[model samples]
Target: MAETTTDSVLVTESVAKYDGAETARKQPPPEKPADVRRRSLVIVSFWLIVLCLGLPIWWQTTTIYRAKLPLDDMLDWAEGRACRPVFPLRISVEANDLQQQEAQNLLRLTQHALDDLNDFSGHHLRLQLSPPGRQNESAEIEDTSALTIRLLPGDSPASALHPYSSILDITYPPNSVPTQTSSSSALATYIAGQLRSTFAEEQAIISYLLSTTSFSNEQRPQGLTPEAAESLAKRTTRSLKYSPTYHLTFSLFTGGHQPSSWDIEAAVDEFMRPVLDVLTPIHNFTIDTQIQLYAAPSVQSQVLNKEDLSSFVNAAEWPLSPSIGGAPTVNFIAYIGNQTIGLPPTDQDASDGALATSQSWLVPQWGTVYLLPLPEDTTHVSVLTLKQPLLTFTSHLLSLLGTPQSGSLPLRLSTLSRIRSADLLLRASSTLGSLARLSLALPSISIPSSVADGVAKTMAHLRLACDTLGTPEALYHARVAEQEAERAFFEKSMVGQLYFPDEHKIAVYLPLLGPVGVPLVMGLLNELKAWRKRRREALEKGKAKKDT
Candidate 1:
């Protein structure tokens, strides 16, 4: 057994020796110069291709798409430097009772008084004497006149605005008319005061807009007192942004199965259609009504406080999604509950008439809510019952659309168009500015070509709107600019990839590149070293032969 074991060990050693010798014998001889040169050339070619072609392809594929924009111009628009809004109102003066010379003199004095009283340069009233013969053609002249002044001699100086027209009628004593040489007169001052009072709301609104934006102090009007500014701010905040259309939603929310249905369609048609028809020139309306049963309010107190009104809408469970379109939704919710808002003094309620009322409350930029207390057995709400609520909704709707509080329906709608145009213009400019600042702050963020196109379109439309303000076309252009600017600022590609860091990109690429790059680089380096040594040796040999 010992001999056999020894034989096995000897056999293993002999086999290992034979295998080693066989492998050594099979090994090829050292490479020739041509073979070595070919190998070096192949490695060099591979490295050159990688550096020159592969690297460029990789860089091109991984690079972000950056589009050029007029950053400076966009910033200028945002800062209110590019466009200075000016409202040139032409007030026509009619003095059929007085001579041409007297009318012209009165007009000059009133205009001077107006200029002295005016603190805002952007909004100015220019008085023009209507041609004496144009009195019969007042309809033709009405198109041009922002306001018309009709003078009549009376016992005392008193002024009244024509409720139906933008006409101010003043009964002045004969002595109140300005003489040819008189620098100032009571009649002129009275007219100026009336004009200021007539435009008080408009002036306050425009001033509020300027003050809210980044307009320079020089551009804003000075007459906005803190109290007035506060009031205007509330009104502005209460109003929704300008839109071509608005979705009117009439919803009946009930805590129980009773009062589940309402005649909302008839109520809207009867009480709201006239107002909607009048608003057609400035805005369009789409109506939809729904009945939600077993609905609960967020707050259940019998006497809801001021804060409770804000949370009354059960937003989580309520189907109050905005209409699936560009237009914003105005929700008119009629909740069936006995909850009453705690009463405040007359002064407190006056400041917040919409929200403090027991009948209904208006939610800023959202909609109105009416708490309806019904009998336990009541199931269907009649059109008559819905009348008061619908009327309340109509009045609040006007406020939501930013209509002038004081004016005939026609005049208010006209003012709405102009106000909306200016609002959209300023909003678009502000958005452009925001986008410009964002781009500057984030240099690495990739701005896609679509964003550039949108920006270009916005600026072009903005210019057109700025030049044609107060006209319907201006509102169209302003809307386009606002839409385009919003689109550019919210570009999905730009926003989604804006925060991706360089470290993340490197981490993603390292695994694929490390194994391949090291081998290729080391092979090239070794070949270069060998070639350099061979060249140096050849140079030394040549020198030795020459010396010999």
Candidate 2:
């Protein structure tokens, strides 16, 4: 009985404790509509800040601002569709001895013959008769006339080009003169043939240039001989890239210490100054001279072969640094040594007659090296001794500047201007094409307004250059176009910006966006799930009421 009573008391105590614990549990009131709506509004407000304000701010800071460009017109210039180059050469005829009517007839007949002979349409030689006493107007004629043909009577019909000026002296027999009634004469035919021969090389070179470019079929030059084509190709390759200014470095390099000084300044002033003065209107030159003693060549040969010429320059030790400007440097080295050029190995016993005439070798696109076999004990090279080398350097300079070999000095210089203009025009066009292709190739690259401006300037100047293809202005405009196009194409900021790829953007933004995005997303999702549950419960309750 006592055990049962104890057990009942224990159970009563345990049950009382459990009932007290259950009564002690607290339950808050149900959430009001106003509170729940306020919570949802807070969530929406946060989302609205992110969607409307935050995203725009982020985009504004990170977006790439690219200026628009005239891509199609640029492409047209690049592909040679915008302009075709045509150079009309005007030749003035001075017939002081002939009557005006007779001179006009001869000019007409010669032009007809020239037209029949000329196959290159891009180049035309139009003859104009200078008024009788107007021939003394040297300034005006020099500016306009490409060449002046002076008619002089002689024992036989002959034509000779003036060595110093752009004059072609033609002597015609008294009977060979064309009459007003005659349709043709031997003098006219002779003049036409002579003119054709005079410009034949220029025509071939221009034709080759056209043929090699994106020129259409009609503009291509016809009947270029294989020999002429080969010669032009060599000439083009041998010439240095054109610049408005050139830095000529006259260096006297000697392996020994004996010949340490030279009279280079006097020699240059005598041999090179005249040509430079004549070329002043086209190109500018700045000269400097140096003497290098104890200078060893890269090739340790007593006698140099044609093969040794390639590796002759001691590039590692030579201080042949380019001048401190945009102008290109040309090194004229007078190496004082007893070394001579050996004939080819294929001809062991052949006469060294042809090789003896040339103590120097031309280094294409660089400069010339004249091997002066001075006495071992001699210390100075006089102005007389440098005459041959200076003359050789001058000749090489002309060749390096792409002067045509066949024409007279004045005519060659004129032709060089035209050639250089054409070259620059083509270079600028090619650069534009490359830039266009590059823009297409890299879409993510940022284009600045400066780049667009440069491109616009390039195209503008390019159009002008194309219009004035044969004139000096063509060269000026082409140079400007080239410079601007290169600047635009090689924009450092654009090239640097190209590397900031999409992957880098993601990496940069991931830390900030990743953490902020997850919490906002999860909270919105939880709110949505709770709202869906509430809607389902309300629908079930409405169904149950309808059933009742």
Best by TM-score: 2
Per-model TM-score on C-alpha atoms: 0.85, 0.88
Q: What is the lDDT of residue 464 in candidate 1?
A: 92
lDDT of 2 by residue, 1-548 (tens): 99999999999999999998887765566678898889889899999999999999988987777778877887777667887878888999999899988899999999999999998888889999999997668557857888888899899988899888888999988789888889877889999999999988788778888877765566567888888788788778778888889999988889988787889999989988999999887789998888888889989888877667767788788788586587889888888887877754344221321112257766778887788988888988999999999998888899889888987999999998888788888788888888887788878788888999999999999999988878888889988998999899889888897667789878988998889999999989998997898789889999999999
Model 2 alpha-carbon drift over 4 Å, by segment: 1-32, 181-185, 215-227, 344-357
Clashing pairs in 1: none
lDDT by residue (tens digit), candidate 1, 159-241: 87766666778899887778898989888888898888777777778878888898766776787899989887778878988
For candidate 2, the lDDT comes to 0.84
Query: Lowest summed lDDT over 10 consecutive residues: which window, candidate 1?
Result: 345-354
Report how far residue 383 has shifted in candidate 2, in Å: 0.4
Measured with C-alpha atoms, the lDDT of residue 264 in candidate 2 is 91
